[model samples]
Target: MSNYKFILSGGGTGGHIYPAIAIANELKHRFPDAEFLFVGAEDRMEMEKVPQAGYKIEGLWISGIQRKLTLKNLMFPFKLISSIWKAKKIIKSFKPDVAIGTGGYASGPLLKAAAGKGISCVLQEQNSFPGITNKWLAKEVRKIFVAYDNLERFFPADKIEKTGNPVRQDLLEIADKKEAGIKFFNLDENRKTLFVMGGSLGARRINQLVEKELNFFKENNVQLIWQCGKLYYEEYKKYESDLVKVNAFINDMKLAYAAADIIISRAGAISVSELAIVGKPTIFIPSPNVSEDHQTKNAMAVVNKDAAVLLRENELDEKFENEFLTLWNSEEKREMLGSNFKKLALPNATKDIVDAIEKLLKKAA
Candidate 1:
C-alpha cells in the first residue's frame, strides 16, 4: 500500500487556483486518506479560495516584482528569500510525498523549497506562453504538465506532459443544457442564448463593452446569461431585463456553458480549455491586464486554428456586435468553430496528471 501526501501550490487568480484544486481533488479521489496542503501568496484570492475548496492553505509573504521601478520591487529579494525559508519550513513539517505547482508567484518559492528537499514536484503551466514563474520553476521540478503544446522551449523535454487543463468534473459532461441550464437561469430556450463571462473577478473593459452593447443584444433577438463579475454587477444589473440574466457571480458554470449557443469570455487558458471542451463557438476578449500579455497569446493559440474568435479588448466596443451577429446567424460557422475547438479538448487531463504524479512518487519511493 502506498501513502500519498501532497503540498499543492498556486494562486493569485482563479486560473492558477482552480487548477491546483482540481489536481488536489483528483489526488484525493484516488488516495482518499492522502494529506494535502496548499501554499499561496499571503493576501491573494487563493488564501480565501483554497480553504473554501476544503483544504488547509498556508500563506507566504510574497508578491511579484512590479514591472515599473517602485519601493515594492526593492522588497522582492527579501520577500523571495523569506518565502523560500518559510516554504522550506512548511515542507519539512508537512513531509509531503509530492509538491505540485499550478503556476503562480507563490508557487515559485513553494515548489523551489520542495524540490530543494529532493521531493517529487510537478508544475502545471496553463498558457501556451509559459509564465515566468513556471518557466523558472521548470528547471527544478521533476515533471511539467502543460495544457498547450510545444512547451519544451520552457521546460525539460523529458519532463513535459501535455495534459490538458483539468476542468471541473461537472463541466466535463453537460447534461440537458437547454432544460437544466436555461431553467437554472430562468432563461428562454426559444431564443439564441449568449453566455458572457469575464472570468471570476471580472474584466472591466469587457463588462463595459457589454454594457455599451446590451441594447444590440435585445435588438437582435438574443437572450443573454451575463456574468458581469462582482465588481461590475451593481453598475450593470440595472440594465438587466427579460432578455438578460445578469449576476455578480455565477456558481453554476456547467449550466452556463450548457445553455449557451455562443460565448463571450476572457481568453484565460482555463476558460479557453473549458470552451474547447464544451465545443462552443466563442469570442475571446483577452484582457491586457495579465502578465506577459499571455491572454492574447492564449486567444491566438485557438483563434489562429479557427477554434474561436479573437476580439482584442481595445477593439471590442467596435467589433463585438458585428462579430456576435456574424457568429450567431451562421449556424455552419458555429459548428465549424465548435468542431475545431472540441478537437483541442483533452478530457483526460486530470487522470493523466495524477498518473504522472503517481509514477514520479512510485519511482521516488
Candidate 2:
C-alpha cells in the first residue's frame, strides 16, 4: 500500500468536523503510514476539535456569507481570496495525494485550491439539500458521497454516490454496551433513559422545552442524559440531579447512545445519521435556523420512513407532550420506530467512503 498524504477540509460545527475526522480515522487505519491534515474555519470548533481527534489542522479565514446582500457579503470576497491564497500555500507545501471535503464553507477555498493544483478531490454531502460550498465544488471533485436521495439534481449524476455520512464506528456496538453505559452515566438500570442531544453548542429552544418538561419526566420515572451543549451549559446545569445527568458536551457518544431508551435530538445531518445507527426510538426537533430549513427536511426524511417523530418549534407546545407520551407508553411503537430507523443505517459508510478515496488516490497515481 502507498503511504499517502491526505488533506480533509470541513468544519464550523460538529456536523462537518466529525465526518471529516471519521473519514480520516478510517483512512489512517487502512494506511497506517499515511499523513493527514485538516483545514477548517479559523477559531471555529474544528480548530479545537480536530486536534482533539489527534490530527493536524490549518484554519482558513472564512465563514458562510449572508444570503442577503449586506456589508457582510462585501467581506466575503476578501476572506475568500485570503483563504484561497493560504490554501494554495498549504497545498504547495503539503503536496497531498488527495483532498476530501465534508460539506462546510471552510472546505470551499481549500478544495477549490487543491483541485486547481490538480490534486484529486472528493466530497461528502450530509444533508438532503446540498450546502453552497459542495454545490460550487461539485463539478470539480472526483466523487460526492451523499447521505440523502435525489441529490442528482444538484450534483453530477455520475459522481454522486449514496454512501451515507461517515459516523463514529463505535456506535455499531451500542447494543452490547447497555450495561456499561448505565454504569458510565451512573443511572438506575430500572428507569428508562432519555438521551437529549442539542448539538455541540446546544439548542436554546430545545433546552427550554426540556427544562419545562422536567416535572413530566419525573412523573414518568425517566432518567436523562442531557447534552445541553457548551453555550447553554451554565444556564441549564443547575437542573442536574441523581436522575438527571447534564453535560456541556458528550465525549463518548457510544455510551450515550447505549444508555438511551428514547432520544430527543436536534436533526442536524450527522446527529440524524448517528441516531439512525443507534436504532433508538427518536423525537426530532430540527432547528429552523439552518440554511434552507434543511434540518426540518432531514427530520422529515426519517419521519417519512416512519422511523421517528418530528415536532416543529412552532408546534412543540401543542404536539411535543402528546407525541412523547404516545411513543413513551407504547413498547410496540418504540420497537417499530427503532427497527425502521436502523434499516436506513449504512453501517459501512465510513469504509465505503474511504474506499472511494483509495480509488481516487490510485487514479491520481
Candidate 3:
C-alpha cells in the first residue's frame, strides 16, 4: 500500500492554479491513499477555486512585490518572513512526503520552507521565460518541470525536465468538431467561426477592440464565439447577435476550440499550452498589463515558429481588424498555422509531470 501526504502550492492566476491542481489530481489517481493540501495567496482566486476542486487549502498573507517603490514594497520583507514561518508550521504539522510548487507568489515561501526542512520538493514552471519566483527557487528544488525548451539557461541543466504544461484532461480529445461544437453554441454551419477568449477576468483592451470589430463579422457573413470573461460580460453582452455569440464564460472550451476556424486569445502560459494542444489558427493579442511583458514573450514563441500571429494590446486598435481579415480570407494560411502548432503539442504533459514527481518520491523513499 502506498502511503504519501503531498503539499501543493501555486496561485495568483489560473495558469498557476490549474497546473498545480492537474499535478495533484494525477498524483491522487496513482496514489489513492495520498493526502493533498494546497497553499495559495490569501484572498486570491485560488482560495475559492482550489476548494471547488475538492481539495483542502491554506492561505498565506503574501502578495507580489510592486513594480514601483511604494508602501506595498515596504511590506514585502515582512510578508515574506511571515509566509515562510507559516509555511514551516504547515509543513511540520502535515509531515508531507513531498512538496510541489507550480509557480506563483505563495510558492516561493512554501517551497523554501519545505526544502529547508529537508523534504523533497519539485517545481513546475509554465512560461518560456521563467518567472522571478521560480528562478529563485531553482537552487533549492530537487527537480524542475518545464513547458518550454532552452530553460537550461535559467535552471540547472541536471534539474530541468521538459515536461510541458499540464492542461485539463477534457481538452486532449477534439471530437466531432462540426456537429458537437456548432450544436453547443447554436451556431450556423454555413459561416466560418472565430473563437475569441481573453482570459477569465477578460482583457479590457481586447474587449474594446472586439466591440469595435464585431459588426465587421456580421457584414462579412462570418460568425464569432466571444468569451468576454466575467469582468466585461455586461458591457459586451449587448453586442451579441445571431452570428456573434457572447458568453461570460465558456464551460466547454474544448467544444469552443473545436468549432473555431480561428482563435483570438491572450498569450498567458496556460493559454499558449492549450492552444498548442487545440492546434487551431490563433491570433494572440498579448496583454501589456502583465509583469515583465510575459504575454508578448509567450506569443512570440509561437508567432516566430509560424504557429500563431501576434498583435500587441497597445496596437490592437490599429492592427486587429486588418490582420484578422487577412487571416480570415486565407484558408490555406490558417491550415498551415494549425498544422505547425500541432507539432508543438505535448498531450502527455500531465503523465510526464506525474512521472517526475513519482521518481523523486521513490528516491526519497
Candidate 4:
C-alpha cells in the first residue's frame, strides 16, 4: 500500500510545468517513498525543467494542432495516434496509483490513456478560462482542481474543486528576500524599482510598450528590472542603463519579486497567482492574442475584486500613462492595491491540492 508510484503529465510552458512540479514536491515531502514519472512533449520546456527539478521524465512525440490547416495540423491524427500508443506503454509500465495532469498538450493523450486503463486521474487547471486540452479531458477526469470560480460552465459540477493553483515553494516566503533581492539585482536602495515580465518567451506588445515608456520611468524616478524575453533581448538590450536592468529570461524570480516596489506584467494565470502572493502593486496588461481571451479573463478576476489594475492591449496607448501615474503618485493607492491583492492569494494551495490527491490515492488503495 505504501511506496506509491505516480504519473504527472503536463508541460509546454512554465504555467503547466511548475504546477506539476509543485504537486510532485509536496507529494515527495509527504511520502518520501513515492516514485514519480513525468510525461511531457519531447522538445518542450518540461523536458529540460522536469529533470532540473530532480525527477525522472519521459517525452512523447506530441505537439498541439495549430489553429489553421497546415502540414502540422494535417499530421495531427498521426501525432495523436503515436502519442496515445506511447502514453499507453508508459502508463502500463509505470502502474501509477494516480495520474495528475496540470494541463498541457502532453496531458491530453497521457491522461486519456490513464483513464482508459482505470487509473485515478485528476486535473489542475491554472487559468480562469481553461485551455482546450483541459476542456477535452474534463469528462474523463475524476476531479478537476481550478483557480477561478464559475468553472462549472465547462466542467462537471460535482467533480470540480476550487483549490487555487500550486506555486513553487521558493515563492511562498518572500518577506525576507527583499534585501537579498535588491543586492542580487544591484538595484539602488533609494529608488522605487519596477519589475516587468511578459512570461518565459517575453511579451512583444508589453516589450514594445516598455520601450516607448522608458522616459516615463525616468520621469517617475523609477528603476526597472525588465525581462524583455529572449526574443526581444537584442532589440531592447540597448536601453539598459544604471537605472534599467534588461534580462532575456529570469531564473531567479523569487529575488525579482522581492526587489520590486511595483510590477507590470501580462495576465497569464501563473503570473497573476504569483503576483497575488508577492503582494506588490501591479498593473496587468493581458495579452489579446491568447485563446478565448484567457489572459483578459484571468486579469479581470483580480481587477473586478479591486485587487489590481488591468489594461487591455488596445487601451495601453490611450490610458497606460495615466493609470500608471495614478498608482505611482499615490502611496496609499499602491499599498491598497498590494494589500487587497494579497487578500486573494492562497499560499497553502500546494498543500490543499496534495491533500486531495491523497484522498484519491486512498480510494484507489
Per-model TM against the reference: 0.96, 0.94, 0.98, 0.95
TM-score of candidate 3 on Cα atoms, chains taken together = 0.98
Model 2, which residues run further than 4 Å from truth? 68-70
Steric clash pairs (candidate 3): none
Instruction: List residue ranges in candidate 4 displaced over 4 A.
Output: none
Across 13-90, the per-residue lDDT of candidate 2 in tens digits comes to 778888899899889989999999999999898999999999999889997889899987999999999999999999
What TM-score does candidate 4 reach? 0.95
Q: Say which candidate scores most in TM-score.
A: 3
All candidates: CA RMSD in angstroms?
1.4, 1.8, 1.1, 1.6
Please list the C-alpha lDDT of all candidates, in the order they appear.
0.88, 0.91, 0.90, 0.92
lDDT of 4 at 289: 81
Cα lDDT of model 4 by residue, 176-235, tens digit = 989999899898999889999988789999999999999988988989999999998999
Each candidate structure's count of clashing pairs: 0, 0, 0, 0
* Candidates, ranked, TM-score: 3, 1, 4, 2
Candidate 4, poorest ten consecutive residues by summed lDDT: 163-172
Q: Judged by TM-score relative to the true structure, which candidate is superior, 2 or 4? A: 4
TM-score of 1: 0.96
Model 1 weakest 10-residue run by lDDT: 169-178
